[model samples]
Target: MANNSDIKRRDFVKTAGAVGAAAAAAARIQGAPAIQKVKAANNQVQYGMIGTGGRGQYLLRHLNSIDGGRCLAVCDIYRPNLEAAIKTSKDKPKGYLDYRELLARTDIDAVLIAVPLYLHFPITRDALLAGKHVFCEKSLVFKPEEVHALRALASSRPKQVLQVGLQRRYSKFYQTAKQMIEKGMLGNVTHVYAQWHRNPGWRMRQSPDPKRQREWNWRLFREFSGGLTAELASHQIDVATWMFGAEPEFVVGVGSLDTMKDGRDVYDNIQLIFNYPGGRKLMYSAISTNKHLSLFQGTRTEFGEVIMGTEGTIEITVGTDDEPAIGLWFYEPGPPKVEKAAGVKEKPVIAGATLATTGRGQIGLPILFERDLVTGKESFLARELKYARLWLYKRGIMVPEEDRNPVDVELDEFFQCCRTGARPKADLQVGLADSTAVILSNLAMDEGRRVYFSEIEKMGRTPEAKGRKA
Candidate 1:
């Protein structure tokens, strides 16, 4: 196993020699494309932001690097959060206590929503109705009705851009992986396994007041949050569906509040299986116990996905504050082909060997997606250097990474779309489908039965109707 120093050194060498002679060769061979620069109509897309909480502030930090959009206003129900937004904003955006007031602003061309899950629909609906292009965070809609309503509403506003916050869609690593899958690099993908675990998960916010406690700890309550499913599983589920090229047919799961007695109704551990057509499946788990991750040789912790196929498997995860995103592939080691007599019955190969026993001592190949630019175009030397780096990567001596973080790219693209009327990759349909998965996965755990994905078509149909009480 590689040590921390080994990991750091790998990242360092890759970073230090990211681009040189070999890069140019590969680009020349691969047709290196020029980067697209968004031309803003009036310098920048003037936008307002609502729900200036932790997520809202985190996005604002990334937005600082994006020049295509300018924040003109911010809104939050909490005074402190509104103040925090103003502090985070580079343009010194005006702050409002009520989101409605921010939506009424005429100067803003779009709105970025980072509010709580329950409030995502209402604020987004209002933002669209107010004639602003909207950028909403993931788990787009809380309820099934919100899914239908938002679909209809967003479709009606064709001129407006509605981008969701599934930033992995904007990642070059993920894009390259998808391309490989399409090109049959990973033949006949049959299963995807995903997990997001945390130690001492979801720390309850301290508040003396009852109302404030509920509001602060919304993620732990059924009415205001979707718990682990919406908060964590939603992202991975989207990844699984994207890789599989289909929505799940049904979901069945078990969840319980086995630990963490912190006045919360949400479960502390969950295990779910999503069945797709053609016998494909996605197995997902989220636990609030240990943070030990099962991928990347345990180099990373908390969250990741393993996509399995007949030819190979890819283990991938999105980046976080301190860790760069990574994707590693491993080829399957199947038995050698042999001719059999006609009508002869074949026994199962290695029937006693389970995943636990068979999934060891395999080498992982890092997926290289970044390109190098020497002066302007590709060079033969750069291409050579690229191959050299790949050799180091295969030996676990170095690892390659995306040149730019996807979060910033996704945010930048939102502003670019606002300027050029371009459609976002993570648009309305993708967001709603992801939300639908979250809704159903939670329902499966709650009802203790299999929940069909189609059931979402009927859920939340009645006005003011609620799902099962936690």
Candidate 2:
């Protein structure tokens, strides 16, 4: 929670513990006590991939787009996905029906395990034991036991890196927001509200074979996925955890699978409340109905968190690249506009003068501040400064944002971490914590009772790290 001005080139590295120690020790040997080195990869790391499904293909695209390491091979149980992976690979990375065979490759320095939630632990466990760094997707482990075990394995191999695919952790805008939050922009944030509403779940592939239907539409099942909670809610919950500067102590919720009567076991609408120890709460919701909440321009059903604070509120959404990261802020009714009754009214100045609507004088904006928006403008700094400086900005300047993908940034950061042997922002602990939220929340909804985060089996630690943010 350091201020922006205090953050140096390597300041971010200091935020992590074990990896930061190694980095700091290395810097010390060079007669300088740098805070720590960003746990970015040194470009010598080579990556192997497992699972070439659509998600896996997306990772492949990111791998090919950025440099840190190249994919030497990919593995999948399915033939079509393997074939697609081969075509996707620039080096025409070797394909294997068995992930074990791919892990055996000598050239592979790290592995990107992109399998479903059920397969996450075994694949990741095997990769870690193979002495390969791991970049697994979110909900790093499905059950409580895997969380304990994987964390222990990671601890045993302290030198190796393990990162979760919570992309926002690597985003520049999100990081900037974190910095802003730490700097007291929100003045003791109080409550957060978020929602993710979509239509008919995801389009299920037309399937004759039951196995085919299950494999392709894993998201719709309970045994395979936690529906939107693990698949979608995890991201926003992570944002809540980040912005609140702590993890929730407990969760309570109500959910029903009223819509999408398409034999999907997962709920269609879920409303959850996470309770932080500081008396703060995050009210979160997700529904697979009409994707219409008017947040993030309706591209997404759930726009973002409405971070309420003493000073003001911020709306944030880490959304599609075609649009951009969305955010806007409203200053709390500035000190109650006072009206002076000077001439003949015989009355003194009064506090309440002008009234406003709930979300007034705020602008919806692209968070990235893209290059095209900066062109023809003198300076981005000027635009930002001018808008913020005004008492009331009559001519609001547009914030520029990238029309391209944010996964690019997320992947690049992962590679950098792998090469440098540094801990990623979304390291093992962050992923597990987010997963904890999911598991506990689901429990809360199912049981019709409040579920404390502590109620779920805590991962890794034999004796809990009680009271500290999970």
Candidate 3:
């Protein structure tokens, strides 16, 4: 119930004081060892990009910033995107209207694909067949059949790496969170809540005909996109899957076009709960109604996750896609209970300070409640179990490295996988799992009933092939 200003003030104080605690978290993450340089090893990763639209261009800029990779070719149906990529990369390596032409470059180390969700499977498969590694974005495939096909393709080409653009998988904060989960820091984490609220859907480019313009937008149509599912909820769904260490067994949700009634066929709002194995569940919601956020640190409007457990809860966000993926952890398990017999003071102990008065004002960005940083190396798993209780006694906040970009990290990771045969964290299976969740959740919402994950499985490897479309 804190106002935005009040949230800001409270957060500023914590961040101002958390500088040391943040360092402790970082040092522990690096094993207090000398930072080894993991830059794309050989720099010989020559790459071409397909679907040179907004997303392609976004990655193009990042690819340029990376030290070793070179953009060898640009492909897009539209002239503008290809031209823009050409300009940004400053490499007149080659240009093609058809992606196949770009794929023909024998020297190209790999292909960076950023296309419509519908086309992910074909382009990625073709890229792999072309004997080039692939760095494709998620939802990996539009339908379920692509899932099995790509998995098979990847297996056949085990020598080459096929990575998806689910950058959070490469994030350090999330990496830390996953380690914490494995170590039982949250103590029986059983439920999670994730959301992404935006004011409006994608804006279409102006065109001669309005219908053509809509078609060009692609994201607003079922044929080209999965509405809020593939376009938005995919990330959080992956987060839930990753954090929980398992896929959901069942899902139920509701989708409505109540918010952005702009004549688009896809729903503008959706709410879903995924029941994972072992009684764990994920509560998710995405709406294009407002930009108001309820995310990490309880301070900023953001795209983040809250992992709830028995001993404590951690609220975190993926840091910039670049060198540092920042995340914060808060150890607030639940509300304080009342014991009337003997009146005693209940206060939050964080870092080394007792935060009794809510710090007067707002919570700021990059806020870390100091008490959260425990010696992660003491006994990796055992210490986290004990620290979860102690951390609930406090919290820790982390910030992004100056100018570090997630897009850059994703691009670099893709390139490295392409060049050195390194398997990426977000591989084909990971992306498909996320896409499958999107497809099934939408089905559950549309059918107005709970849907079993088995239903999706029974459909087929490629859900689309089985006639279950997203």
Identify the candidate with maximal TM-score: 1
User: In candidate 2, what are the lDDT values of residues 247-269, reduced to their tens digit?
Assistant: 99989899997757777788878
lDDT value, residue 281 of candidate 1: 98
**Model 2 vs truth, CA RMSD:** 11.3
Task: Estimate, for each residue in 1-470, the C-alpha lDDT of model 3 and write its tens digit.
Answer: 11212112124224323533443355457643121122333556777888788888887766767876777788776666667878878556567776656665576767888887777877776666666778888888887666666776678668777787887776556766788778876788899988887776565457544546665767887877888888778998999999888999999998888756666788888889999999899998887767676654345553678888886666776654433444545454345685656666666667856566454333322323223455555667776755565444233423433244555666777766665667778887788788789889888988999888777556654445457433
Question: Which lDDT values do the candidates have, in the order given?
Answer: 0.82, 0.71, 0.70
Rank by lDDT, highest first.
1, 2, 3
Quality of model 1 by C-alpha lDDT: 0.82
- Span of 10 residues, lowest total lDDT, candidate 2: 1-10
Candidate 2 Cα errors over 4 Å, as ranges: 1-42, 296-302, 334-397, 402-404, 458-470
Model 2 compared with the native: what TM-score? 0.78
RMSD of every prediction: 14.3, 11.3, 15.7
TM-score of each: 0.84, 0.78, 0.75
lDDT of 1 by residue, 1-470 (tens): 11212112123224323332343355458753222222345668888888788999999988888878888898776677778989998989988765666766677888999988987877777677666889999889898888877887788678788999998898887887888799898899999999999998998888645546886788999988899999999988998888888999999999999889988999999999999999999999999999999799889999998989999999999888688888998888776678998999997878656765555668788886746222345577876787688778889898877878899999988887877788999999899999999999888998999999888877766544433221
